[model samples]
Target chain A: MIRFDRVSKRYPPGVDALSDISFEVAEREMVLVSGHSGAGKSTLLKLIAAVEKSTGGAVLVGGQNVSGLARAALPYLRRRIGMVFQDQKLLFDRNAFENVMLPLSITGFPRREAAQRVRAALDKVGLSSREKALPVMLSGGEQQRLAIARAVVGRPKLLLADEPTAHLDADTAADVARIFKEFNHVGVTVLIATYAGDLFPGARRLQLEHGKLLP
Target chain B: MTAWLAQHGDAVRLAMRRLASAPVNSLLYLLAIGVALALPAGGQMLLANALSLAGTTSAVPHISVFMAANADRGMAAEIESRLKKRGDIKRVQFLPREETLARMKANPGLRDVIEALAANPFPDAFVLAVADERPEAMERLAVELRQLPRVEHVQLDSAWVRRLDALLQLGRTAVLVLGVLLSAGLIAISFSIIRMQVLTHRTEIEVSGLLGATDGFIRRPFLYYGLLLGLGGGIVAWLLVGAAALWLRAPLGELVRLYDLTLVLQTPGTRDSALLLAFAAGLGWLGAIISLQQHLRKS
Candidate 1:
């Protein structure tokens, strides 16, 4: 669950990234944030993840005030939230399996348990056979799927994906949407930021324009 | 506890893998650290042997108590016997004036000078070897001997010993300063290498940060990396010192024999080696920690 009350983020030299934004997402809810470039979607996700502090008001995730969280406590708060960026930030030096296992490894899961979960996550992302392949060897669509698998491998309470399917084809995009729905059905709150509004039909949509939530 | 150990094991394995990924670079770093460490460690070994040799040789500080020229042989005997009874005196030998003159005549260059003297100017003396060769100890013995009625003068061979001690002290200070400077350089080198590693993995680090990885989790492998480098450097330094000692052992033994002294060249012992290894490792860890702070702040 996430709640934002008049949260604002302002950069140096008079640039407003997010201005008085307010929103709420219930437990296990699936919501798509549709916004154009510079619409503060990324900033909003960062606030929830505690990656960046909000300039004004409060942002809460899992009932803890994220805006006022201490630096030492940020990691623990982040552990329960999964985030995906558009860059696909996969470590190419390692194989696909290693990339997917990063989240679970960070949490210090046992070796055998990590391996099994990594395999299961890969299989779920349709990357079971490509576990040994490097990120450089994977196609764009497969890379995005790998990122998704990594984001959810730790079974985080909330998932925040920024333009996850931006570079994928229609079929791959729909496949990604199906994965999100599958996760939401099992009580994992999911928030996706993308400009394509039709990607997730029947899902709640929160539109933002120039850092403000649209009515 | 088991899980914590398992995590550390994983970190160590991962660090090894990371190091192996760039063999040439890692080896070069290790060599730099080894050479820096070897200088002081090697110097310490050599200086220890030299100091021990200086202690064992004729450089042992002693006092010579000279009796009055008119003093009888009975007085010299009395002094020798009295000195022999003291626990601080390791040995006391009486040298009669006639015997001293005869011994001087045996020296080819001193014969003419000795024969030219009108009277046997040499006086009855006692040569004392003290258990403690410290300047103060020798001076104390000399002061006590000077108080004797028949004694003309008490000469303590302390000046030369004092000079040698001063030189040895200077050598120790030099070694210490060298050690400190080299260690600082080693830490700096390790810091640079770790900073580069972090830069290379910048994206991965940021991603992990976003994935809820703790700062300690991110820093674990680099810390291990620093520790491994330090340990490797320590081993290399020890080997270099050992090899040098091995090469010099026989020659040094011959020199010691020529000087009529007992001293043996030795490599570092277990405790010394462990200390070097642990110190190097600690430096590496410190460097990695410093770099981690800088890089993590940015992330």
Candidate 2:
């Protein structure tokens, strides 16, 4: 579970990324954060993940106030919430399988279990056969799918996607959306931030205008 | 603990893997590290040799006992007996008046004067050898030996001992200064090199940070990189110092034998080698930590 209670992030130069935001995602909800470029989409995801500090108010995930989490516990907190970047962010030196296995490995999964889970996640993203291929060898859509596999491989309780469908075609975007839907169906909470219209259908949409959440 | 290490192990493993992938570069760094370590190691070998040579050959412990002018030959002989029975005394030789006159009798320049003298004109004396090898012990034994009736004076043969001790002390100081300066230079070199790498890889590190990698996860590989470089450097330094010692070992051994000394150079002992390895790793770790502080805040 993820909750934000009147969370506001103001930069030093008087720019507010997220202003007085209050929202929550339940156990298996698929919530689309629909906003244009600077509607605090990434900031909101960062707050939930404890990647950035909030200026005022609190962001809670799994009953731990991330705003109040100790620095030492931040890593453990991050281990539970998976984040998929718009960019693949794959290590060029590593193959697709290794890339997908990064999260599980970082979170201390056993090798055999990590391999099995990585295989399953890659299969879900339609990258089962290309696990050994490097990011440079994979197409844009394949790389984006690899990113999704990496995020989901650890079986995080919360999945936060920041424009994960950016580089894919309409057909490929729909395919990725189905992968997200399948993950949500399996009881993983999914919150996707997207400016890509008609990408994820039948999802509860929360719009953001400027720094304020649209009612 | 197992889980944390399992998560972070990739950074260390990857760093080493990269080294294996670039064998030539790795060798180059190793060579640099080795050269840095050899200097003080060789200095240590030099000082060890210099000390044994100076201590044994230069200073031979000896004590001198003088008799009172009024002391008769019988009383001086009694004193000699007392000195000989002491456990600290190694050996004693006495010069009685008649023997002293005889020794003067043998001197060609003093023979005329000795024959013309109305008196024996010489008090009896004893020379002592102390069982103690060190200067301080020999001095104490000499003072105690002079306490006999008719023993008017005592001398500890310690002039050469003092000189050698000073020389040895000076040599050690030089070695210490050289070692410290060299170690500091190597650490600085490592720090700058790692800093350069951090600057070059700035964008890559930033990306890793933004993608939810923890600060420590990003720091892990760099730590390995620092450690490997330092260790490789230390090994190189060890080899270089060993080769130089080997090259000079026979010639130096022969030169020492010419001085009638059994001086030997110590190979950098196990303790020294271990310290060098640890030193290398510590220096590298410090450098990487510096780089982390300067960067990695964003990611």
Candidate 3:
């Protein structure tokens, strides 16, 4: 669940990343933020995750004002919401299984349970066979799938992904979109930021241009 | 509790694996720490032995009151009687000049020197074991004994003990200073090592942070790495000091034999070894914490 109240973000030298952005997503809802490159889709998702703070107005997630949250409290907020960055921030040295195991490790999940969950998540993302392969050894689609497995392994209530299928073939992108839809079908709130709105049709869409939200 | 322990165990294992990945670098760091620590630890061991020797030689303080060379046995007897009457004097033994000369002549090196003298140059003396061993009290008693009639000089035998004790104190202070400086060096080494590790793992750390890893979680492995380095160094230092003590035992025993002082070079005992390990580990942990704080703040 996320709510943004007239949120505005300005970078240095007076560049507006997001301007007068106000939107709300109900629990268990799937929403797509569609925007052109450098059109503030990433900034909106980052504000919801508290990865970046708004220059003005408040961004609320699960009824908590993340903008006013203390630094120590940020981790708790983040742990409840899984994030997939555009760059696919997977640890290269770790195998696919180990990369997926990171979130559960951070939460101190029991080793046996964490292993099981990681396997199940990998299976869901179609990455079960490449569990032992390092990120560098995996194909682009496999790496994207591995990143998704990692994001969903902890079963976070809310998932935010930025350009999850940017470099994938249409078929692989469709598979990735299907995995997100599957998670959303199970009552997980999902917000995806992408320029390719066609990949996720029939989902509620918020379009942004020049840092302004379009109705 | 099990989960908490499991988390810590995981962290420790990760740290060990990272260290193992760079065996040569890790071994070199440990050796540097060991050599730095051993210098002070060895100095402390020698100082302990010296203090022990001093303790054995000066268990009881004695003052020797000598009669003037021209004075006779009657004057010595009188001085002995007066010394015995004092409450501070525990016991007094009269040493006649003839007995002193005889004892000197018994020494093989002094025999020829004594035979060269025309008459016994030895003076009659009273050896007093004093009740109080304090330096001021002993000096005061010695001054009092010197003022007695026909007394040539009063020697406080504990003066050499005091000097030896002072020298031992200085040695202890020097060892403490060395230990402190080396500890700083150890801490700096840990800091630098951890800083490099953090940099190498920069991407992993950033990913972990984004994945909701706490500060403690991010810091745990690095802390354990530093701790292991220090612990390994402590073990190495203990071995070095123990080996040195063993190697020097025979030669040191022979050296002390010439001085008629029996000294055995004892290796660091269990408690000392534990303390060394704990101190080194603490320093390493401190360095790791500081490095993490600076890196985290900057990032």
- Candidate 3 regions exceeding 4 Å error are B112-119
Reference-based TM-score of each model: 0.91, 0.83, 0.96
DockQ of each: 0.71, 0.35, 0.84
Q: How high a TM-score does candidate 2 get?
A: 0.83
- Candidate 2, residue A154: lDDT: 74
Candidate 3 local lDDT, residue A51: 86
Error of 3 at B18 (Å): 1.2
* All candidates in order of lDDT, best leading: 3, 1, 2
**Residue B291 C-alpha lDDT in model 1:** 82
Label model 1 with its docking quality class.
Answer: medium
> Which predicted model would earn the best lDDT?
3
Per-residue lDDT of candidate 3, residues A1-215 (tens digit): 78999999999999999999898999999999988899999989889878899999999999899998898988888899888889999998789999999998888999999999999999999888989999999988888888888989989999999999999999999989999999999999999998777888789999999899999
Error of 1 at B14 (Å): 2.3
Kindly list the per-residue Cα lDDT of model 1 for residues A98-176, writing each as its tens digit.
9988887788888798899999988988999999999999998889999988888888889999998898899989888
